[model samples]
Target: MTERKVIWNGRVQSDMVDYNGHMNDASYSLVFSESLDALMETTGLDASGRERHAYTIFTLEAHIRYLQEAHEQQALRTTVTILDQDAKRMHLWFEMENEDGDTIATSEQMVMGMSTTTGRPGPFPEEVEQSLSPLPKLDREHWPTHANVQMGIRRK
Candidate 1:
C-alpha cells in the first residue's frame, strides 16, 4: 500500500480529555476528518478544484476501530493509504499513531464524488483522475474476509 505524507500531526489537547482521563472518541474522528481534507487536496479536490469542477467528495460510509487509548498532550500522527479507488469512489484506510509509534486508532472510509449542482453522484475531472491514477490500490480479493470487513456480520 502507498502512504501519503503525514496527513495530520498534532497533540491531543487537555480540553479534549474525557472524564475517564483519556482523549475522547470525538477527537479521533475530528483528526481523521482533518486528515481527509488534506488527502482530498492531494487527490485534486481542493476548494479551488471544486469551484472549477462543480463537484466534491461526499462520505458514503465510514468505519473506525479504537485500537488504543491516548492521553492529553500526546503527539498524534495520521497517515492515509488508498485502499481501493474507482472513477466515482475512493476507499481509504488511516492509521493514527502516537509519537512512540503505538497505534491509537484505525479508520476506513468510502467516499464518492458528487456534483454540487446536480446533487448526484458524479465522475471526477479528467485531471483529477489522472492525478489519482498513480496512487496504490489494494486488491480486494486478497483482503481478509473475516468479520465485518466487506461482508455484513451477524452474531449467531
Candidate 2:
C-alpha cells in the first residue's frame, strides 16, 4: 500500500460546527470534495481541462466513517489515495485529520467520467489519462481494512 498523500490543508471554521458543537457531517463531505478538487488539478481533470474535452467526473457513491470529532478553529488536513482507476471511473479514499495527526474522519468515493455536453458516461481522454499515470497506484490497505464502509450519507 502507498503512503497517505496530503492534498489539502486548512482550519475548521466555527461556522462548520453543528449544534452538537463539532464539525458537521456535511462539512466533512465538503472537505473531502475540496481535497478532491485539488487532486483533480494535479490529475489533469480540473474544470478548464474537463471543459476543453467536454467531459467531467460525477460522484457515483461515497462512504464516510466518523472516527473522531473536529472542533471550531482546529487546524486540519486531508490526505487522498487513488484506490483504483480505469478508463471510465476512479475510486479514491480520503482521511481528515487534525494537526496532531489524529484521524477525524475518512471518506471513500467512486467517481465516473461523463460527457459534459451530452451528459453521457464516457472514458477519460488520452491526455487526461496520461497526466494521471504518474500518480501512485491505488492500494486499499492504505485505508482501514476491516471497517464496514458503505454508500450512504449520514447526518451529523
Candidate 3:
C-alpha cells in the first residue's frame, strides 16, 4: 500500500468562510481542485508538459464529505492517495486535515486524460505515463475507511 502524500497546504482565508462562521462547502471543493492540480504537476501534466504533449486531465466525478468545521485562518493540509489508475483514468482520494491532525474533510475523485486536439478522453502520453508509474498505488485492501463509500440515508 502506498503512503498518503501531502499535496496542498494553505490556511482557510476570510473569504472562504460562510455565514455559518466556518469554511464554506465551496471552499472545500476549491481546495480539493487545487490538490488535483498539484497531482497533475507531480505526474508531469503541468502547464508546460500538457502543452508539449497536447494532453490534459479533467475531473469526471467528485464526492466530498465534510467531517469537521474549519474556521478562517485555520491551517489546512491536503494529502492524496492514488487508489487506482489506468492508461486513461485515475481514482484518487484526498483528505484535508487541520493543524492538530484532525480530518476536516475528504474528497474522492475520478479524473480522465483528454487529448487536447480531440477534446475527448484518451490515454496519457508516454512521458506522463512514465511519470505516473512511480507513484505508489493503494491496494484495495489498504484503502482508507472513507474510500468508496456509498452515500444515502441509513435506514434501519
Candidate 4:
C-alpha cells in the first residue's frame, strides 16, 4: 500500500455522546463524511474545484462497521486509502483510529465521476485522473474482509 494521508482529526465531543456514554452511531457517519470531504480536497475534487472543472464525484455506495467504542473527549484521526480506481470510479477505505492506532471504525466507499455538462455519469477529467492515477492499488490478499460486511441484503 502507498502512504495514506491523515485526512481528518478531531476530539470526540460531549455532544456526540449518547445515553450509552459513548459516541453515538450517527456521529461516526458524520466524522466519516467530513473525512470524505478532506479526501476530495486532497484530490482537487472539492466543491469549488468541481465547479471549475464542471465535474463531480458522487458516492455510489458505502459500508461502515463500528468495530470499537470511542468515548467522549477521545482524540481521533483518520487515514484514507485509494483501494482501487480507474478513469471514472474510485474505491476507498477510511480508518478511524485513536492515538495508539486502535481503530474505532472503518468505512468502505465507492464513488463515481459525473459530468456537469451532460448530467450523466462519465469519465473523469484529465486533471482529476492525473491526480488520482498515482495512488497505490491493493490486491485481494491484502484487502481487509469482514464476515457480515456485504452491502445489500442476501436472499435465495
The clash number for model 4 is: 0
Question: Using Cα atoms with residue i matched to residue i, what is each candidate's TM-score against the true structure?
Answer: 0.85, 0.86, 0.95, 0.86
| Decoy 3 TM-score against native | 0.95
Model 3 poorest ten-residue lDDT run = 128-137
User: Local error of candidate 2 at 24, Å?
Assistant: 0.8
Q: lDDT per residue, candidate 4, 1-156, as tens digits?
A: 344668899999999999999999999988998898887777788888889988887888888889899998999999887777777888888889987888889888998988888888988878777777665556655666651265677899
What C-alpha lDDT, on a 0 to 100 scale, does residue 8 get in candidate 3?
96
Model 2: lDDT of residue 63: 85
Cand. 2 TM to true fold: 0.86
Q: Between 3 and 4, whose lDDT is larger?
A: 3
- Decide which is better by TM-score, 1 or 4: 4
After superposing candidate 3 on the true structure, give the runs of residues whose Cα lies further than 4 Å from its correct spot: none
Give per-residue CA lDDT, model 1, range 60-156, as digits (tens): 8878878899998889999876777777988888778999977778888888989999999988889888877765555766432321375467788
Native-vs-model 4 lDDT? 0.82
The CA lDDT of each predicted structure is 0.80, 0.83, 0.92, 0.82
Worst 10 residues of 4 by lDDT: 141-150
Q: Please give, for residues 29-147, the per-residue lDDT of candidate 3 as tens digits.
A: 99999999999998898899899999999999999999999999999999988899988999999999999988889999999999999899999898888887766678899998878
